[model samples]
Target: MTRRTFLRAACAAAVPASLGLPALAQPAAWPARPVRVIVPFGAGSGNDIVARLMGDHLGRALGQPIVVDNRVGANGSIGADAVARSAPDGYTLFVTTNTTQAANPALMKKLNYDPIKDFAPIGRIANTPAMLVVNPSLPVRNLQELITLAKSRPGKLTYASGSAGTLVPAAMLTHMAGIDMLHVPYKTIPPALNDVVAGQVDMMFTDMATGMPQVKGGKVRAIGVSSLQPVASLPDVPPIAATIKGFELLAWYAMYAPAGTPTPIIERLSRELQAAVNHPGLRERLASLGLQPVSSTPQELADFSRSELARWGQLIRSAGIEPE
Candidate 1:
């Protein structure tokens, strides 16, 4: 059978008719304790912030305390592994980004857990694009000029990455542009962006959450967007694909539970997540950070995860990056 057909059939089997209208258990006894939102990034990072926001809203909806657990290290593998190995109970949920679910699958040499097998996808939270910003000292006005300069300078130009995932798109751009550039890695994008704005680094692909504000404030010059289309937050910025065909890089956030969590619990969690993102306060906050809240059914999230895993794996291998 064709891949699409197989996928549809598989999803159908997983969600049989008997599972219709999600079984609602007694709400009073459901969340007897605090719900832990495990974030695989340092505090104040985009993922952590999103988790906290959602946690607060989810807490209100469930009438329980929602705590954020920041676990940072090894390009998010350390924290992701913690969630993967956690008990299948509904209390511990992972709020993560493309780094662990998509990029790390191929970027890491030995991932402690399989992203697909170790966690059950609850829902997709948001999709945010990154901005390609250059230091004022670069003298390049647009992506073409930057490429031309890189072609001329070769390995002299320097770029920075907050993490492997943050850098993967830049590395891919370098490979596609056929230009050699030095890569500088940082633990978070904020510091790296600071260096770019201060002219310490030549250029960097930065998170739209921080980069958009800086670009608007004239702190840094935004030359292009990583995605094919201009983002709503920055409509004037050109897409990289306008100069180089088929270029796209978008960071995303998702929710997941430890594998083997009961279907009823997963459904309940997905419902709560949908409600959380749909909340106006939470939606506005995410939008301010250049995050577009996206609600996805469990099957849709699973399909999206599968596709993202395949795409990022291709990019990471082509970039020749190794996990630490």
Candidate 2:
């Protein structure tokens, strides 16, 4: 089947009606205990950052604690699987990104959880583009300079990536620029960014939400953004497309619970999420982190998730990356 046709067909089957199980029993007073939000990536990732941001507000709104637990591994499969297998009660929710939901299906040869089938969409949180950053001591100051340096060093230069959103751009650059750089994979972004800060790796594409502090701290130098245009947070940085035309990638955040979660609970969480993202103070905080907070309803997130899965798959193939 054509990709669009397959996406439509597959997505049509993902509606709540098709997720068959009846909602499991929840607390007499929902969220009677501390609610746990599983963040598949490590600390400081866009997903983790937003989870804490929204979770704090959600917890306050719900009169319960929102515990953000990081279950990092396998580009998020390990944590995603944990959420997928959890009880469909409202207590255990997931705050995650495309790495586990949309991109992993294309990036992995075998996936343990069905992104569409295994989770109930709660709400979308925010979006952030990536920045190509290098250690401050790296001789190169811009994309071209970095490309020239990579060509000269060839496989001697190393780049680290913790997830697909971070990994694909560097791979695309090497493929498009015709340079050879060694790839070092990590389970999450913070440590990868840490190595870049410590000068263990030459460079990487990091989501702005997590990379901005490092950039402003002089720990790393941001040369280009993955957006078609420059980001407001780092205005002086040009689009990577300006150097290598048409290069762009964005990471997004969303909330979910195991499939079969009660509609009432999902609706309540969605309402709270909408409130959290809409709050003026929270919006300003997210903006400062380089994340654009956009709240979406459950149905909207479900449809968007389905579409993004197909789009990320196509982008992965076009970038010349093979599933592992």
- Residue 232 accuracy (lDDT) in model 1: 75
Worst 10 residues of 1 by lDDT: 20-29
* Model 2 per-residue lDDT tens digits across residues 75-181: 99999999999999898999999889999999999988999999999999888888899998999999999989989988998999999889988888899899999
TM-score of 1: 0.85
Clashing pairs in 2: none
Task: Compute each candidate's TM-score over C-alphas.
Answer: 0.85, 0.90
The best candidate in terms of lDDT: 2
Minimal lDDT window, size 10, model 2: 18-27
The alpha-carbon deviation from the true structure for residue 170 of candidate 2, after best TM-score superposition, in angstroms, is 1.0
lDDT string for model 1 (130-185, tens) is: 77899987889999999999999978999998765579889878988888999988
Model 1 stretches astray by more than 4 angstroms: 1-28, 320-324
